[model samples]
Target: MSDIKIYSGSSQVRVMEIKNILENEGIEYQEVNKMDSSYAGIFGEIQLFVSEADAEKAIQLVETIKNK
Candidate 1:
């Protein structure tokens, strides 16, 4: 049961939106904050991962949200 990365970006708002979407759809996810603590909001990307079994559906959900 490997995890597949479904989204990665520097926008906190967008990241939160994606997390909500995934939650609403009952998709489990793992989030990784890769930002430099010193720079915080100004640097790095937030990554979201889902199980490989759910990767396709998770990606489609993410894309739909992003297109809005």
Candidate 2:
């Protein structure tokens, strides 16, 4: 179950939304902390990752959200 990123960004609201959706669907995911350490996430990217097996599914989920 190698980890792969399904989404990356600094949008807290958007990221949380997708995370909630993933959680509801029972998909396991990892959150990679890419935020700047000095400012504590002032200007950096956050990544949402899932297993390779769930990559496609995750992407689809994200796309569905995007379409909404």
Among these predictions, the greatest lDDT belongs to 1
Off by over 4 Å in 1: none
lDDT by residue for model 2 (31-66), tens: 987888786547898899999998999999999998
Query: What's the TM for model 2?
Result: 0.85
Query: TM-score: which candidate is best?
Result: 1
Candidate 2 global lDDT: 0.90
Span of 10 residues, lowest total lDDT, candidate 2 = 33-42
Clashing pairs in 1: none
In model 2, what is the error at residue 52, expressed in angstroms? 0.9
Q: 65, model 1: CA deviation in Å?
A: 1.5
Q: Give a tens-digit lDDT track for model 1, residues 1-68.
A: 89999999888899999999899989999999998889978889899999999999999998898888
Model 2: runs farther than 4 Å from truth? Answer: 37-42
